[model samples]
Target: MDISIHRPESLSGSLREAWHRAADESPGYANPFLSPEFAAGIGGFRGGARVAVLSEGTEAVGFFPYERTSLGVGRAVGLGLSDCQALVHRPGVTWDAQELLRACGLSVFEFDHLVEEQKPFDRYVTGTFASPVVDLKTGEGGYAQWLRGAYPGLARTTLKKERRLGRDLGEVRFVFDERDPAMLRTLMQWKSAQYRRTSRMDRFARPWIVNVVEHLFRVREEHFTGVLSVVYAGDRPVAAHFGPRSRTVFAAWFTAYDPELSYYSPGLIMHLRMAEAAGREGVRVMDLGRGEKEYKDWLKTRELRVGEGFVSRSHPVATAHRLWRRPVRGLRNTVLAHPRLREPADRLLKTVGALRTSGGTGSGRERSGRADPARTGSDRAGPHAR
Candidate 1:
């Protein structure tokens, strides 16, 4: 296998076409995050972003999008933001993980939420996690009918809340694909506040992240389109979600709601609305990404397996990187796995975050409009997505 590296934008039209074709041909690579457009979007803001094209003779066969630091440590492109990570390739095209890292001059390549079908890097995976997803299906009366049948209890409860919200707040209505930029800003503000309240890093604090999100909101393509779904009560926006949608799949990304209306369960209402609306729009699957949550359990029809690991080319830099990074991830997973440990950890983070916010010195990144470790590392009000 011949590996050639280029900036995401530097990939020629033919190479991009081939990449898209490869993604389209496999269920594993069909994630919107795997789209070349997404890589280019990341490249536009992240100077380190690059794509490695794998070829046989003169034929392009695979694409690996990643970010390489000057020290030679590499990560999957939009690592924290991308819910799905992989070396997207056509069926039957494979390469050795260490060789691939060596070819790209990467001392180490780290990833989380990697698609389970990535066989080439299978051996490197340290652990696997469940990524919840809704297998959207239409019935006789459409999404509403399908939803009622699939999740009757959830449907009954949420619809009841919607009605109560409407009766108390105003007419509850959902816009499947809202195009208003102001509402997007509102979503961010609410999301940022949610982060602050939870004692998490606010992603919107980073200017580049805001710019990238705004840029993505305008992107409309067959392979990937940025979708912002909103739920409103009268003139007030109750909840909103913004994420990318490929031809067949919609990734559940950033979702937030009016915290004051928390009693109404607007977040749950919003996702249900988005799912129904998305199903109506011809989307077949809604990938909820990784991380565990009760809402995910209630909403998902099935689960996709994803892996997390580090791939290295055997070097001092790789060893150093692993030593520094693996412990952090291990600590995080340990806390998340046990509620007794998790509660205290969360309290400590919240205390730190409270101090940071109060002192006007934060994690330096805005909490909203940015992806979290895998799927926005939080047991969300209702949900969180990257």
Candidate 2:
């Protein structure tokens, strides 16, 4: 096996074609996050982004995308934002972790959402967590019928809310793949407000992140496409979602709604609508990503295991990086794994959020998006912890 590193944009068209072929042939590598388009999207914004190609004779058989920092530290591309990460490769293709690291000029490679099937890096894994997903099936029925059949317990209540929402506001309508750019901006604003109100890091506050999302919104490809789904009440937008999808998989990414209309459960409505529409569009699965939440439990048909850890090559930089990051991840996992610890942590964060928002200059709804009394536990998006 021979390894060579190149900037994502520098990859030849034929090399990219081979990468897509590998993804199509491997069931485990089909997530949109693993697509070449996504890697290039990140590379366009992040200067450190690079793709390591593994070739056998004249044919490229594998691709590993990552971001490299000074002192030989490396991480999965778009680590905090990407829900899935892997060295996408064809079946029967394998490489030594140490050799790969040497070839890429890395002392350590860190990843949180590493796919379980990545056997070459299996020994580097420290912990594994569940990533919930919906197995979608479409036929004669539409969203309403599909919802009823898939989640009998949730269907009645959710459908009832949709009806009330329509009657009170206006005729509630859903667009599975909304092409409007304005709605995309609205989603970012709402997500920013949600983050601030939850006392979490506002991803949209970063210019690069905003640029990347905007760039991806324009990307339309068979292997990866940015989908923006929205729910409207008459002429008013009630909720919206923006996520990436491969040919067969849709990854649930950023989702937000009008805080004033939280009582109507717009967030839940948006997800159900997205799922049904996606299934109709030939999507076989909707990945909710690696996080635990009440909504995920209600919607997921199964869970995929993702590992987190560091792959290193006996260097001081590798050892130091592990020592610094491992404890932080460990502390966070402990809090999330147990309700006793998680509940207090949540309350503390909310208190801080309330204080922070109250002092800021914004509309009450925008300032307190996550603090709305009408928004129950079920309405919250899973925390995208860094």
Using alpha carbons, what is the TM-score of model 2? Answer: 0.94
Pairs in clash, predicted candidate 2: none
**Which residue runs of candidate 1 sit more than 4 Å off their true CA positions?**
142-144, 347-386
Task: Give the winner by lDDT.
Answer: 2
Q: Please identify model 2 stretches exceeding 4 Å from their true place.
A: 359-383
**Candidate 1 lDDT over residue span 120-168, tens digit each:** 7888898898888999876668545766887797777666767888999
* RMSD, one per candidate, in order: 4.7, 3.0
- For model 2, residues 181-214, the per-residue Cα lDDT tens digits are 9999998988788677767788899999999999
In candidate 2, how many Å is residue 156 off? 1.2
Winner by TM-score: 2
State the displacement of the C-alpha of residue 53, model 2, in Å, after optimal TM-score superposition. 0.3
Q: Estimate TM-scores for all models.
A: 0.91, 0.94
